[model samples]
Each structure stands twice: as C-alpha cells, then as structure tokens.
Target: MMINNARHSYVCPNCHSALEFQTKQVVCQNCKNTFPIDEYIPDFLLTNQEDGGEKLKNRASRFDDLSKVYESSNWGGSPRIVVWLLTRKIRYKAGIGLDVACGTGVVARSMAKKINYVYGVDISMGMVQKAFDLSQKNTINNISFARCDSENLPFGDNFFDFVSCSGALHAFPNAEKALKEMQRVLKTGGVLTIMALLQKNIHSVIDPTKRELKKSSTDEEIIEFNKAHSSMENLDVKLHRFTLAELKMITKKIGFNNFKYLKLGSVLIFSVER
Candidate 1:
C-alpha cells in the first residue's frame, strides 16, 4: 500500500495553515508545531481541549471490542444495511471522497473501489488502525486513514467531491459542528449523505403503552408488547435518534441545498448538495 504524501491537500488543524510532511511527522508551516505520524496515519487530535476530547479517545480505544459485541447481536443486521445503503448511493464512480467517523473503513473501502481516492477519518486511533490495516491487507492503494476529529477536519476547503457519515452521526458529541465541518470541506455541488438511526419520541410513548398493555395479560396486549419490543431492540447505547423532520431541519439550518431523506431498513439516509 502506497502512502499518499499529498501534503497540499491537508492543513494544520491548529493554525489552519499548510503542512510540510516530513519522514515521520508533519510540521505546521504557520504555527511551526509538529504532529506525529504514527504508522503513516497523521494524528491531528489535540491533547487538552473541550468537547470531551480525551473522553472520546478513551471510548474509541474500547470501540473495536464493543462494536464486535454489538455487531454479533440480533440487531447486527443494521451494519450490513448501512454499508449497502452507502455503497448503493456512492456507486463506484470517479471522484475524491471522505468518510467521517469511518470505523474499520468498511464504507470507505467500498467507496475506494468506486472513487479515485478516499480518506477515512476517525477520533480513535484504534479504529483508524483497523481501517489502515484493511487498506493494506486488501491492497487498496487509493484509500487512506487518519486519526482526526470530524468537527475539525485537516483538509482544505472545497477539497472532496463527496462526503459520507454512516451510522456514526448520532455518536458525534456536537452533531452541528461536525456537519458544518463536513460541508466546509466539500466542494460546491458535491454530494453528502448522513445515515443514522432516528430515535423517535413516539418510541418512548409506545414503550410505556406496551408495558401497560402487557400488564393486562390480554391476548391483544401480548401481541402489542412483542411488536413494540421488536422496534425498540434496534437501539444501542450509542444511539441519539432524531426524527427525519428534525434531521431535515438541521440540514436546512446548516445551509445544505437540495436535501432528500430516505428510509432503508432501520436507518435514515440524508443527502444534500453543498
């Protein structure tokens, strides 16, 4: 796997200045600050800052194992559906792309097959390492991985032709900041898609209603509980579900154009033009 030393495509997350890529690190031309390059993956994460930076990193380290447990559950089908939904939308085509919060690079790898180049960025180095390994093992030369924050992308403005955030938007500490950063890096007319599980308030109301119905022990009550449980089972600890209307309003607030929403299986897909 060749490391793309495209230094010009990235900038310093601190000073927002161009970077000079060295053998094992990058020097900020403006700030003169140096960031380490571990295993060819740039580390753009800051040590001390707000937004639960350290907490997010700690969680990321344990994410690989936790994700495996989740993926092995009955609700595991959601991951496959997420990949399929994103791949179908990306369509193996020629363009530069970015996958925010890309875990193990599954979607990014899939997009690499279709696009010219794809960059996958995640907050956790553990997840980024897994993604980097996937790229090398599969010999996908067009894809790269970096340990970086989504709300503070290192890439230049109007850099990518398309952007994607699948099944991870809900986990973002600041969804609006991350979404705005995504839009900032995307070129005008570029396409962006966000796939997530919308946590509906109706789910809360229905859950209690189902419990009440079950307490009655009537034949109809049992049926309602089963149905409600089936719907609730899809949720995970990391989920921050929002309705399609709520998400659309968010995209609108972010100034995204030509927004469209789709429901594929258990996930909601939001697409917009930058």
Candidate 2:
C-alpha cells in the first residue's frame, strides 16, 4: 500500500523465504508450508526449530557492547538504538514498560531506570535467562525478563503505559502480528516506538568476511569497528527492512498515529501515540 508493488517485504519467518509485499501469502514457495497473518501482521514464531537460548546467551557480551553505543551504534544496535531514542521522547518513570523481544535485557535495563517496572519478553527462554544473568551481574533489579511471544503477549490490555520494541518485529514471521500485539497491550494514548534496519541501501564499514564478531589484534585495530557495523546479513537473525516512506504507510495500517521520525540512517526510529 505504501508503494507501487514496493520492492520490499518481510522475510518468511517459518522457512526464512523472502515475502511478497502488501499481500497475504503465508505458504512459502521454497518450503511448501502454510502460515497466517494475525491481524495485519504475519506470525513468524516457528515450531520445532531451536529456541533462541544459545543466541540469547551468546548475546550477553554483544548486547553489553551495544549498550555502549545504543544511541549511536552503527551495527548491532538493532532496537536498542531506537529504544534509546524513544527514551528521550517520553517519561519512563511511574509507568510500566515492555521491551518486547529483549535479547539480553539491554533495553529492559534502560527502561527500568525510568519506569517503575519493566518487563522484557522474548519467545526464547534461553534469551530470557541470559537477560536475567546479565542484569544480575550488572546490579539491575527493577527489570524482569520473561518468555512470551510478541504475537501473543501473556498480559492484559492497557497493561503498559509505554511499549518499546526495536529489532524484534522484523525477526518474527508475522511482523504485522507482532506489531499488533505490541499495540494491544498498551494503555490508550500510550507511546509506541520502533526501530528497524532499513531494507534499502544498507552499508557498513565492518569487514564482511565473518558471521560473528572478529577480534582485532590490538586495541587500535578494533577502533575501526568502534561501532558494530551491520549489514542485512549481519543481524543475529534475518529480518525485514523499510525506508521511512514505506514504514509510515505500514504503521498507519497497524494503528499508529501522531508519528514522527528521523530517516536516512542505518536504523530508522518512529514514535507514535496510541
């Protein structure tokens, strides 16, 4: 709806097939399996595959590195960078906030500083567990991590005053469903903020020879990667991307209004009022 057969769409969450934009097709041509979109979003949480525990566990150090530049991280920032930006837009104190799909509780910790209580939800219990360990090791207590699906959040409506999610949506099979779920649990007029990598024209300075982080021989050698440089393939998990123009149309259909944003960066941030 945002563009004329827009050249971008979500990746198949189940088989990781590239999706067709602006349409409702769940069966992957390559995998020959059928899935469905819940609400306007797709539901990408797969079954019988591996849970994200190991990935989440591994994310501890990486996520911590992310916190250092959450506001300015070029790569590996995912949603933390967006969360950092939104934290500046609204008051977090005296409210309940959710870091949906929190990897290692990085955003959850940031949320706890301003909100009375913060909940970090991810489908991977492994991720949740690591988040807890990292938070504990860092002396963070106000935040709690849980295993929950963003598509089917295990909480009541109007439960949160402000809700924030970054890289989680794109990773889901049905990002649209996850988006609706994020919108569902918030109080009326609550704030909803999201950040995701741009689908078009992404570039980074990091060496492209690896899947995981490569260590530099010296401190100065690491200076070039001072920020985690990311590309479409660099994401711990594959996800969708969007140009600001396309995102605005998608958010409108997802029931987001009063939106504002900053474009032309590796990550795009959007703020809305429910």
Estimate every model's Cα lDDT from 0 to 1.
0.73, 0.59
TM-score of each: 0.78, 0.61
Candidate 1, poorest ten consecutive residues by summed lDDT = 69-78
Q: Candidate 1, residues 150-209: lDDT per residue as tens digits? A: 878888889888899986787676788999999989988888988877754335534565
- Candidate 2 lDDT over 1-274, as tens digits, reads 2122112333343444554543553555566544444333333444433764344344333434444333232234345455568676556478888888776666777877888777776664445666677777878766665454576664566668888886655556577787787787788889988766676433332344222335423443344344334322354654556667777777789888888887635667778888
lDDT of predicted model 2 = 0.59
Off by over 4 Å in 1: 48-53, 64-78, 200-238
Q: Which candidate is the best by lDDT?
A: 1
lDDT of 2 at 61: 36
lDDT at position 137, candidate 1: 86
Name every residue pair that clashes in candidate 1: 92-114, 199-241, 199-242
Cα lDDT for residue 273, candidate 2: 80
Task: List CA RMSD, all candidates.
Answer: 8.3, 13.0
